[model samples]
Target: MQSAVYPSLAGRTVFITGGGSGIGASLTRAFARQKANVAFVDIARDASRRLVDEIRQDVGVEPLFLACDLRDVEALKASIDTARERLGNIAVLLNNAANDDRHRLEEVTPALWDERIAINLRPMFFAAQAVVPQMRELGGGSIINFGSICWRIGTPDLSIYATAKAAVHGLSRSLARELGVHGIRVNTLSPGCVMTERQLRLWVTPRKQEIILSNQYLKRLIQPEHIAQFALFLAADDSAVCTAQEITVDAGWA
Candidate 1:
């Protein structure tokens, strides 16, 4: 599908987390196509390098791919610093790193719970913290935090993921209020059942596919590009006044 070119995005610096695979990879490709200077961090070196090669070949631009573990706040900050040093000031931050690893309630130990929180929620706040000064210096910016519809739908086997996703909205709203004065917009971008490679392999069986199709008003699968398009609007000047809002790309599943 053809998409709009956000003139405002050209030359702007964008920092993304977990941008090696799945939906994060889609965001990296989409933003790079718009002529944005994209810098993304992920621990998946192979996937990240492949994605960079793909984007470079297809879009004629290569995004800066930094290997990072989001659970390490200091490392996360260092990644942001690397982006600033190489790509210029960050104008858009897509807090898209998250793990929706399903776990039963009984299986959640304290260490496991902390690990879940670290992957699904903590990085978003700290990443936002790291970029605020850069955004402020640039006059204004956008922070699009990823949320899951699992929480709203109360999907089973994702207790910790859903809980962390639920917390994302509160974090976003709070950040919006605090950063609005600095012209920084923070909002949650929630997506429904997307058929990413990981999801298809681990979760989407025939019955699961049928259930997803039947529940959402639209009968088609939610693609990463669909989320990327909505995210483009959020990150661009088009949604300049939109903040503290929960935007869903669920195909009406919610």
Candidate 2:
């Protein structure tokens, strides 16, 4: 599939979380290809470094990679400041980092629950807080909060994860209403079962893949690039009027 080019994205500053691998990596590459100045935070040091090298060599525009744990709110804010100091005020913020480990309800201890919420839900709110000023200063900006279809479909073994994902929609809509006056658009981008490397390595057995395909309107599994393309549209000025919405690219799976 051919991707659309958005001239408006050229030279814009974009900040992404968990951008070292999986769907986050695809979002990094997609924004870079648009000639956007990209800066991303991830805890995976080796993969983040490699991503920087890859984009620098392949795209000719090197993205800034900061080693950060999103759970640390202060550290996350500091990383955003560093990115801003280097790349200019962020015009697009992609809250894409999330941990989706399967957990049985009975096995989910309080500690595990807290960690899951920290990884999947908390950072998104704080990240938006960190960047909203920049967006306000820029006159307008796009904030794409990554959500999942797992909760909506009531998938098994994801009690904590599903809870966090479901709450993401509320967060997005609340921020949209609160920040619209400042011209900062906040929307939740919920993706269906995307075939990321981690998902494949950890969960996607042949039988599981077959089940996923059988349930979806489209037989083919969703790819990271597909999600990236939708995100590009949301980030660009093309989606200036779109906000407070939950847009799902699930091939009619919902």
Candidate 3:
């Protein structure tokens, strides 16, 4: 692992949700390189364990991995509490766990809409609610939520998902105002179409890929590392004064 580009996080602790694969896993690696005591949760047990093991070997620090579904608020809260017990104070939180249910507005049933909101939007607030006191005890922290470019572009078949992401942007800003007194900074990271495994398997056909790249000024897919880098910036002291803002990392697609 290379040395972290941002300031060292040798003594800080970070808790990231959905850290088994894709952008979340990339963030785990990046933070581990910075020497933060990282704790993450994922629904994929095998992938989460593998990532923790790999980080232990490469960075010589074992990140805590909790396998749980983010939609289960009780389970999610337990996971964070467990991680805190093991890793000390969680100084940074990456609320990155999300699911996109693609459906036209007319096709979106009540259950479907509620599920999307539960998985994508609810955890962000509940997780922050669970961790804010701990963060205050630690003298302040950073809370970074994952938003989506779909919200800005009005993508097809993504009405519910886009709405949920838009809620995240609003949530971050409101939380920033609410938490600022405790020195906790809140921000949102809105990623464009990153070439994650899920995108490769389900979302992006070759033709669709071409269209996406063509829309970008860079004419290339956004990598997970790119988002991870921005996450590190927001996590570290470099973004100390930056809060309540949505930073887009989409290769100029949005």
Clashing pairs in 3: none
RMSD of each: 0.8, 0.9, 1.6
2 or 3: which has the higher lDDT?
2
Task: Estimate the overall C-alpha local distance difference test score of candidate 1.
Answer: 0.94
Badly placed stretches (over 4 Å) of model 3 are 1-4
Query: Global lDDT of each model?
Result: 0.94, 0.94, 0.89
Per-residue accuracy of model 1 over 198-244 as CA lDDT, tens digit each = 99999899899999999999999999999999999999999989999
Per-residue alpha-carbon lDDT of model 2 for 1-254, expressed as tens digits? 77799999999999999999999999999999999999999999999899889998999989999999999999999999999999999999999999987877899889999999999999999999999989989998999999999987998999898899999999999999999999999999999999999999999999999999988999889999999999999999899999999999998772
Stronger candidate by TM-score (1 vs 3)? 1
Model 1 stretches with alpha carbons more than 4 Å out: none
**Backbone clashes, candidate 1:** 0
TM-score computed on alpha carbons, candidate 2: 0.98
Q: Give the TM-score (vs. native) of candidate 3.
A: 0.95
**Mind giving the per-residue lDDT tens digits that candidate 3 earns over 118-176?**
88899999999999999999888999999998967878888878888988988999999
